[model samples]
Target: MTRCRLCGSEAMASVVDLGATPPCESFLAADQLDQPEPAYPLHLRVCTDCWLAQIPPLITPEETFKEYAYFSSYSTSWVEHARTFVDDAAARLDLGTGAFVVEVASNDGYLLKHVVDRGIRCLGIEPSVNVGAAARDGGVPTLTEFLSPDTGSAVRAEHGPADLVVANNVYAHIPDVVGFTEGLRALVADDGWVSIEVQHLLTLIEENQYDTIYHEHFQYYTVASAIRALASGGLALVDVELLPTHGGSIRLWARPAEVAGEPSQQVVDVLAREKAAGLQELSGYTEFSARVAKVRRDLLKFLITAAERGETVVGYGAPGKGNTLLNHCGIRPDLLAYTVDRNPYKHGRFTPGTRVPILPPERIAADKPDYVLVLPWNLRAELTEQLSFVHEWGGRLVFPIPELSIVEVAS
Candidate 1:
């Protein structure tokens, strides 16, 4: 009986139930471990009405981001991606000293720093206190508040409408899709554009990326669904770009509906591709749960076998998606002795449900576990390169998503 968050449709179909899972980003300190951790049902439903896939908002953003641990700056490729976007956007928008830029969910000012470096006026709207403080410390002005219609209007009134607004991988995290999109409309100038990047649902289903499902991420979007969501808030989609990040993502460029902008061929082409993939129909999502169930079984079988063979398994990168995969598989310290992360914030903590202790990357070499599970498979190449030295000791690397397989290093 879960209703769609976007369309207010009660005729939603169950996609996949990932069972009970703790908030993916809720990394725990040692002191709080003795108390019981709360877990919520992680289920995704597709609205037969709007074709939007979503989960109920079981947790609030204020609680989820209070002391956020995930910092975008920790990923080198991600930072470079942001810099490249800034360079291209600045040139494309013909931005000068007077032009203003704003970024929503601007974690740690990873992208806004480049804008400030270019001598442009920029402000970041971020709700996570730790990350907002980090952004301020790094010389980027930021407001630690969630973007809603009211906050967005206030920001526009105080700072003037933004010439360019960027929201990367944040659109899906919002529970109030309509309100968030309306906020985007409010924050941008009439002629200004808003760019949002989200993981393409086609890739999620076709590529078996069920690990991306978690409480923090409330919804998934296809080009059609995105257009519908934007249109609900008086925005028009004018352009689109497909990116390889997060397995596959679509960067949507939108402008206020009142201002006419020619829709880019890329947008039409992507929409066509979505249609060809049957994104407009219910069957496109109904079959995904079966595929996801297979992946879950395969992963559990692999882990159980590894344990039976007396193999010491550990994990690399304690990402939000990693927590989902581990919690979905019901993995605990018994299956994964510990996980390592480069981020110091997560080093001494434990993952939410599985309670897998997170240690520094140096610990991977110190323990030399028989196998290293690359939980963040999206960065497999980068992680494999960093952990290549493990091969010297006959330790293997494994990726559980898409399919569970051992990473074969180039000979």
Candidate 2:
């Protein structure tokens, strides 16, 4: 009886099922490992009516985000990406000292810090108190609440409407697409800008990115689906830019529908591109399950081969995608050993389901593992550069998605 979250239709077709898996962000402590952990159905469905690829919420947002372990500031590439976005957006929007900028799900103020540096008025709405506290400590004013239609109206009333609203990588995470989009419409000024970045479904299906299908990501979006979700909430897509972050993502710019806004050629072209790619049809999603199964098989084969060769294979970055890949492939600690992450929060914890110990990045230099699996392959360039020293020991980097590959980095 699970209806489509966006269009409320019963005509949903199964796309790909990742099986039952734990929440990707739910890192476990050593002592907690003895206790039973619950896993829920990690399946994706495409609405035959609206063509929005989605998954039912296995766990509530309260359970997933209450004490979040993932912090946006942990990734150097992501922080730099945020800075670049702020620089470009500020310049293009002519944001000045008096302008207000608001970022939804502002994890640890990674983006708003740049806004504060420019002396522009900025506010951050983060649900997790832990991350929100970090934002406040970093000197960015943060409200520890989720962005719903109510919160958005209250924020706009209390602080005045924002000139720029940023919701990076959050559109897919929101289960109530209508509420979030409606809130977005209320948060931004009529003439202001709203930027939303979501992982593109076209890229996910094309690249065999089944690893991106975790409970935290409630839905996947095509440009057409994104338009439907936004239009229902009184917003119109005005522009879009495809980004390389998170495998492949699209940054959509929006304005209130009441405003006389015309979508840019970029928006028009991407919609056409999706249609040409057959994303407008259910047939596009039908074959994805078969592709995902092949990825799992290939990864296990590579891991088993490495183990047989007596090579020590460790992972770099215990990201959500990493958990999904590991859990889906049924990879245990025997396969990956341990993964290193820059974030200290996950340093002593274990990856959900796989139970792979998460160590510090320094462990790579000390252990000199034979191969390091770059889990967050979207940031492969950044990780490869940071761990390039692995080449000193003839170590190679492995990528698990889009088929497993051994990368030999030049020193």
Q: What's every prediction's RMSD, in angstroms?
A: 1.3, 1.0
List model 1 lDDT by residue over 120-239, tens digit each.
999999999999999999999999999999999999999999999999989999988999999999999999989999999989988999999998888999988998999988899999
Clashing pairs in 2: none
All candidates' TM-scores?
0.97, 0.98
Model 2 lDDT tens row, 11-122: 9888887889999999999999999998998888889889988888878888888799989998888999999999999899999999999999998999999999999999
Q: 370 in model 1: Cα distance from truth in Å?
A: 1.8
Q: Which candidate number would show the highest lDDT if scored against the true structure?
A: 2
Q: Model 2 — TM-score against the truth?
A: 0.98
Q: Ten consecutive residues with minimal summed lDDT in candidate 1?
A: 402-411
Relative to the true structure, candidate 2 has a C-alpha RMSD (angstroms) of 1.0
Off by over 4 Å in 2: none
